[model samples]
Target: MSYDELKSVLVSLGIPEDDISPEASREEVGLDSIAVVELALVLRREKGVDVTEEEIGGTLTVADVAALVGARTPA
Candidate 1:
């Protein structure tokens, strides 16, 4: 998926779309630890993709998170 599409999903989760960018830092996404967990869980259940905490912990950009989800998504 495109980065823009992934960023839009984050935006829909209450994170400002503008706050998301391939270059933006993870902190810029404003997702607290709980929020991160919540998002990972949401992606797993809704998209049939499993994103673990370790993956979330290593993500620094919105694109990274999206990449992780995309990698785990069924083909």
Candidate 2:
């Protein structure tokens, strides 16, 4: 997944578009523990990406999350 695609997913999860950015922290974008789990599920089930909550939780910024997702995503 690209940055824009991850941003879109975050948006779908009820995070404000204005709060999302490459440099934005996950917490700054309202991605708490529950949101992280939901994001993992959404990525796996909806987007066919096999990312885990733990992996998502390890990321600091939105751009980091996007990079992790992109690495795990199928080519």
Candidate 3:
């Protein structure tokens, strides 16, 4: 999906619109283990996607998370 679409998803996750940049890292934006896991759960429930810590990739920013979600392969 496009970055803009990803940004909206990020915002829905409580991440600010300004924080949805490509330069930010998961940790940089406070994606702690708890939050990450919570997000993974949301992904699963909302999109039927399974995201693992290992599958998080080297994604940095909220935009990166969006890209990751978009990149998720169908089961």
Taking the tens digit of each residue's C-alpha lDDT, what string does model 2 give over 1-75? 899999999999999999999999999999999999999999999998989999999999999999999998988
Cα TM-score per model: 0.83, 0.97, 0.68
RMSD of each: 1.5, 0.6, 2.7
All models: lDDT?
A: 0.75, 0.95, 0.69
Native-structure RMSD, model 2:
0.6
Please give the distance, in angstroms, between residue 4's alpha carbon in candidate 2 and its true position after superposition.
0.5
After TM-score superposition, the amount by which residue 63's alpha carbon in candidate 2 deviates from its true location, in angstroms, is 0.4
Tens-digit per-residue lDDT, 1-75, candidate 1: 456666766777889877777777778878778778877777777767767877887888877877877777787
Q: Which stretches of candidate 2 lie over 4 Å from their true place?
A: none
Q: Scored by Cα lDDT, where does model 1 land?
A: 0.75
Ranking by TM-score: 2, 1, 3
Stretches of model 3 off by over 4 angstroms after superposition: 73-75
Ranking by lDDT: 2, 1, 3
**What does candidate 3's lDDT look like per residue over 5-60, in tens digits?**
65565578787777657778887666777767777777777767666765664566
TM-score-better candidate, 2 vs 3: 2
